[model samples]
Target: MKGNSLSQVYYRPIEAAIRWAGLLRFQHEIVAAIIDSRHLAVTLNCPRCDELRLYIDRIYDAIYHGELPYGQNGITIDDKSLWDSPDLTIRHVDLKRWMLNHYSGQRPAFLFSRGERIAHPVITLEAGNALLVEREALKSQLEQCRSQLRALQEQRKKHDQAPPACTLCPLSDRAEATYLHIIGAMLTLMLGRSPSGTPYSSFNSQEAIASALIAHHGHLMGITERTLQAKFAQARRKLQSAVS
Candidate 1:
């Protein structure tokens, strides 16, 4: 009934010794139960909640860009929009009772001997569905982007002879140069060669090699740390595919 307190939900202490199940059991079970039953999915199923969540997302965008997203002039959240519809509010009350009765205590040995606690039942069904709803929202947004791109291409076709207002710079030459440099650096590192063209005492580790390559030739190779990271990721994928 109170404002959704996010600090406890978001900022749990991270211990290196803990595994995924240990940390995420609370949130995980909440989602699992919601998806397993339709009645428990009221928050996600509610139209008012969808509107409120979209409004909140715009509020976030306003914070970052100093304007509402999607070129909207003005946006606001009202009291009715903040909470659920009457039916859903009653459903929420019932849902909390159900969770408390069914999933509130320690699991028996038959269920899970690993001792996953369901103590602080602060999370609601709507909150549990937040990630799934957000993912769906992203898919919708991406579809909108693809549609806009196709529209732009169609518009460009109508102006066949005219050049676009912004000409896309050709990056093939620069990309080829960067690719060659990376290959050369990787070959040298693999062969245990130092910058002075002498053999090093021992081969460098993959992480060390990546770091050294980025530090020595990142600017010259027209690469940033992020670009080098992508290259490294591609290389790893290639190696994984070959092994598989």
Candidate 2:
């Protein structure tokens, strides 16, 4: 188990080989196998679940599914080398075990979830492979940003095409609802700024505001600014009277 490549036990380890208990051997062993980028990506970015549990689950799944396994030991890159040369790729990550002695907290899982360095490197290669973790984190962030952008754009589109509610005049019934809508559309489209974000220096005249309303929504409303001038003037006078 010396290289980066995954290995089977040369075959499956027998029950005795796997179960032997001694200072030199353990029932379960973690082989420093490379996990796929996709699985690691999900584990890193999962929002609701415990991050430590998420990381553990990913590693366990890889082992269970045989993506990574405890390969045979003392693998050499060169078959002819007389000296002891262990393959760096599949090497046992036992080199980094010293970090564990530093962790005395009872809730190490929680600490690991919070990304405490006292956590084991086996939880993920995240400690060593910063770029891989960062890539996944940034990709997830980018997707969220794109989603928010899409929602904002949709809201802006609807807002541009529609008018805000008219609170100035509350007609009791739809008996004259058409006038309410006209006023609303006028106020929405011409006051201060148009839906297109255009600033207007003056849109005080009923004729001018009505003309803009008609130009924008004439076909759908089936009404002309000429017919609305009287109603518009009546509303304007009411507003002026109230203010004065």
Candidate 3:
């Protein structure tokens, strides 16, 4: 009377061993308790019922017909004392083997339903070699994508903070021309000129343009007056082309 009930002895202990070995990480339980001692078939909670069936078949084969005896104490299935004996335990080595075969590798049988009936060995070891490979590969790809995203974000931030460049002259191709366009727009607005030749005094226009240009492009500040005059004329022509 010190043992589990007949219902518990038959499959519950084995199910617990399977769970202890970490084979049932995603499933809630093996299955609802449906044990038929006559035919000895128990439905499992796994999606592939056939796979479960085959797995159970291997367990039965090992216990009832295979080389290994039932448990550590050499308890046979016919022993009535085993029915209620809570001390009943499968040997650790056997249990380890059972965990490995069922869950570990890409068993040829699991490739398709057609091979489900092809019973092979079942071992339980919670092997994570395959999962570790996939996890590392995914982690590498995710890090690479994150690095690319960060680079794009940095470039966008720099572009947003900088002043706009003219599309026609494009600061990349002609920084001087682009600067001239900006200086001309500032001067035209200040001179009260409405896109017409009826501008304010040309002297004030030139002086303000020079001041604004020097403030922005400080390299022009040290140039001689004659050279400055020539650069101003060139800037005016470039500004006209940009506006047109």
For all candidates in order, the CA lDDT equals 0.37, 0.37, 0.45
* TM-score for all models, in order of appearance: 0.20, 0.21, 0.26
Compose the digit string of candidate 3's lDDT tens values, residues 158-242: 6555655632434465655655664454444445433223333333566665565456544432334555557667766777887
Q: Which lDDT tens digits does candidate 1 get at residues 1-244?
A: 1122211211111110011123222333333334321123444432243433343333333324423211111122223332222111112222223324544442322223233334342455776587567556545654564465355335534544345653454548666454445444443335454333444323456566557655754544324566656766665555445446
Candidate 2, residue 188: CA error in Å?
A: 12
Q: After superposition, how far is residue 36 of candidate 1 from its true place, in Å?
A: 35
Best by lDDT: 3
lDDT of candidate 2 over 55-173, digit per residue (tens): 34433344344443333242423222311222212222311121133222222221133354345334335543865555565456545644653564355356455655633545465
Which order, best to worst by TM-score?
Answer: 3, 2, 1
What C-alpha root-mean-square deviation, in Å, does candidate 1 show against the real structure?
24.1
Stretches of model 2 off by over 4 angstroms after superposition: 1-170, 173-204
Using TM-score as the measure, the top candidate is 3
Which ranking of candidates, highest lDDT first? 3, 2, 1
